[model samples]
Target: MYGPLPARDPVFSRPLQPRVHPAGAGGRLRQFRHDAFDRGMSPLLVVDHVQSAGPEMEPLPHAGLSVATLLFEHAQGEIESVDSAGARHCIRPGDLHWTLAGRGVVRQARARGESLSLDALQILVNSPSDLKQQPPASFHLAAAKVPLIALPGSRLRLLAGQLGAVRSPLVLPQPLLILDGRVDAGATVALPLPAGWNAWVYALSGELALEADGAGTRALPATTAVTAGAHLADVQLRIRGVGTRSHLVVVAGAAINEPLVQHGPFVMNTRQEVMRVVQDYEAGRLGRL
Candidate 1:
């Protein structure tokens, strides 16, 4: 992992398409995704500083993936939801939920309740195609139980993955780290990544000026990609911001290295397979509509 490298000023090189929420509406709404399969080997998308639109995510089907969500509450906030199996659960402010959707699990996500500016992040890790059938599981990590990495003039919440000296929340299929770092005005934190993994950091609250190796320098707007690479050894990050939990998702993973056929929430390997999944769902293969 590389660290303390200056952040590069960011210029959005490519236009970003809208996110895919599911179809249908009322009480709460979600974005529906059109099958967008381009940009091979790239799976990192930074959704920075998106205020909770009263986050209401219902049971949706997710196959072959794991999701990690963080809610950094300056005061208090909560997310409520029922599982695909109709189980009830909620995560309060400062708490986190890690969902591993294996094989064919029906899952739902929704954010409820509120406070002024309840900011947080969610990162998804693609499970290997062969292990998509693994039984899905959930882990709730307490805010106090998470590791805090202290730097010269900054403090970081070690959410997931590893930073040179600090370890992350759980063992993952891919090499990814999620850290929330806060630097006072002029304070700087060297963002070091691990070997055999690529890293990217997005600034959610404060404007960040970044300096990168090949990408040059640029300023990152809210919900922008700081650095992205195929392998872990190829990326580096650094930042200067004045804020708390300058919320960011540090993601690193090997490219799917194959056709990523995704129709809405199901990310499969081929269009034929994706079509089959749709047919199966329609035919009651996954169970329940």
Candidate 2:
């Protein structure tokens, strides 16, 4: 059992109404960008919901950061990803891929065929200051390996981190929790959140309402995101599906609260460190995919 939400807890709700950006060649890929840092949601830097139709390939370069990609059930076809470390993976629907870009890493992903499509969320997490300089690593969690919790009218998938006794097999760079939740119409699900941790909830589809103990309920429509927590008391987020079935994601992590210097994909503690990472990548020291 968790305690009531603190009176001082700040809750924020915002719709995902950002301008759409074109990615990949010929505008085959569309992306909705959400910057958590700019919105005062720390630990999480960016959350991008990307959709692609037809063949597309994109090069990703990173250092001193962590990334997680979650694919939806409706996602079609497969994606082939190759990294500078000679690691390759085939990503399909309902799969979760986590990457730790410690020192530096170059990764490229492409649609396997023209007939396939993609709908997924690409999340960027800030690495701890101490582990930012380590070697790069990656982890893959197949759809079958993900843990699921079923309720009366709701099903929750633990994509990463822990929920009660349920835990994900994949190891993350920091303590974080990622949940994919589906709720039938009129169903309600209560999500327990650790004290002092920040939480972001994004509604993927359907109409929903989010209610905290002390904070009043807030409407959550499709493509909208809500953030809460960083309080001294434990909290539980109650999500109620309205009108139709609802699909959403819940991500929570303790705030890093450290200074961040970012240059494109490179994230470091200071400008000098970011410059060094950029130099290494430009000099071919980070390797090529």
Candidate 3:
């Protein structure tokens, strides 16, 4: 087989209670539920949609999956949801918002300013039918609370992963790791792919040289693609850039692999029976024991 792997970036190797990705190396980017979706075991939808500064978005729906939003900036915005612990909430930069669409909660995003700018990450996590019995939960973390780690040659923000001593709040149902890394000019950063998970890299800004499966190195220009290795274990992402290279990388693996039937935010095994959910709601199943 292959020789023992090399050492990983020390900045990420030591940590406490952090959500580490399932192991392996790097892999190809395969569309999950749709062509536009990212390759997460759970259905992933990444969009760069343009929004008017003060425009309010339409009510969005989530039934069988977990929904989370991370705002970059653009101060004027609100997210309202009836089924959430906080029925209505506002969206602001460094805001870590998560909503469980149990019972199919609805929400809208209202942006302020003159056609305000919006940048956020919305994740859809797969949940089996049994979990649907649980009502939704919501949380908002200040932009400042997100863990930011600075290495000798690069900088990193642990949005959903652990970087050294920093940790994130958005707990994932699956074994997943999400990271945002910025490589300084002429700096090099190495990411150690877990032992059994798949890896995909998305270039958001700048350019860098990368080595995969030890097949030499190649330059990854901006807006490049995610690659799945011929073998699931050939997943390592190394970066070397004269200028800063900004990236968003997601590493994930197989789900619980159970039945994931869902309808209007209710995740259950059978679509035919929605009455229990109704009766439970009427009786405040979530509200009561």
Candidate 4:
């Protein structure tokens, strides 16, 4: 019986910094966290920007989570992934791979080609409590299927959910919006966020500024993220490219507000549930690739 918020301006939060970590061979990762805005980031447990140079990823098990990997424009070579169900996916630039590990699933990926370089965003979303015990599933969306919004000064790719008249073909267990795009220097784009939904903006490169309806503009530097939302009002976020062209991604979803217990790749409602999932994976009940 939830409804949309009343029409009003949006509220903005301060930027959240990312922690740089090493990934695969000669690869780098930037992980973002915002504990103070947990309510605004519910269902969104992890957001990682990864840069890899032709290294294979070890198989990892996950349960009670929905994961999405979106390749950016600078990505080179191909990423081939295989899952426990024996399903294989070949992801290219601008492609997306989404997995719903309701119960459990094991997956791994490797870079293909001589150049052996890859750039992508790996997002981990928590599943609702009710769907935590369901079966695992996955799908891949080619770059061609993603809708594009071409503006005078910017171009946005609808990776998931809806944006204006455009919508992504990839479907998930819950409603979520993801936009990846770039804005030209000195140009601005206005993005609409639904009432009661929480949104996070990430600066992939260059500098940018974000302004909400009634809030002052805030600077968003490279490799940083900022949150915005209003519990009872629909809001529009204005993003302006500063100094130089900017690349960014926007992720938004309604707050689940459920107790979240996580251990590594397992996300559940309680520690007991997580332990059970871990046991299932260790016993090979989750399956092998």
Candidate with the larger TM-score of 1 and 2:
2
Which 10 consecutive residues of model 2 have the lowest summed lDDT? 29-38
Per-model TM-score versus the true fold: 0.73, 0.90, 0.64, 0.91
How far residue 14's Cα lies from its native spot in candidate 3, in Å, is 31
Which residue pairs overlap in candidate 2's backbone? none
- Tell how far residue 27 is off in model 1, in angstroms: 14
Q: Which candidate is the best by TM-score?
A: 4
- What are the per-residue Cα lDDT tens digits for candidate 1 across 1-289? 8779655333112212335343312221111111231222244422323344454556577666666667775625576645554445676667667776665566666666535344555655566677565666676766777888877767787766777777866665555566766665556666554344444555655555554455555555555444444343544555665443344444555545545666676776767766766776666656552
lDDT of 2 by residue, 1-289 (tens): 9998655335544445434676544333323343522245567777877777636456778998887778887888777777887878888889988888898999887777556667888888888898799998888989999999998899999988988788998787688888998999889988787776788888888988888877768788887777777467788888889999989888889877788898889999999999999889989999986
- lDDT tens digits, residues 1-289, model 3? 8999875432121111112222212211212221232333333332222222334445554555566665655434544333324456666665666666565444555555443445554556655555454566665566677677787877666767554456687575444566666776777766665544444454545776666554555565655534332234435656676465555444443333455455544555555445566555555543421
Arranged by lDDT, best first: 4, 2, 1, 3
Weakest lDDT window of 10 consecutive positions for candidate 3: 11-20
TM-score of 3: 0.64
| lDDT of the structure predicted as candidate 3 | 0.50
Candidate 2 — which residues are off by over 4 angstroms?
Answer: 1-9, 23-39
Candidate 1 Cα RMSD after full superposition onto the native fold (Å): 6.9
- Name model 4 segments beyond 4 Å from true: 1-10, 34-39
Regions more than 4 Å wrong, model 1: 1-41, 45-50, 53-55, 85-89, 112-118, 194-196, 230-235, 242-248, 285-289
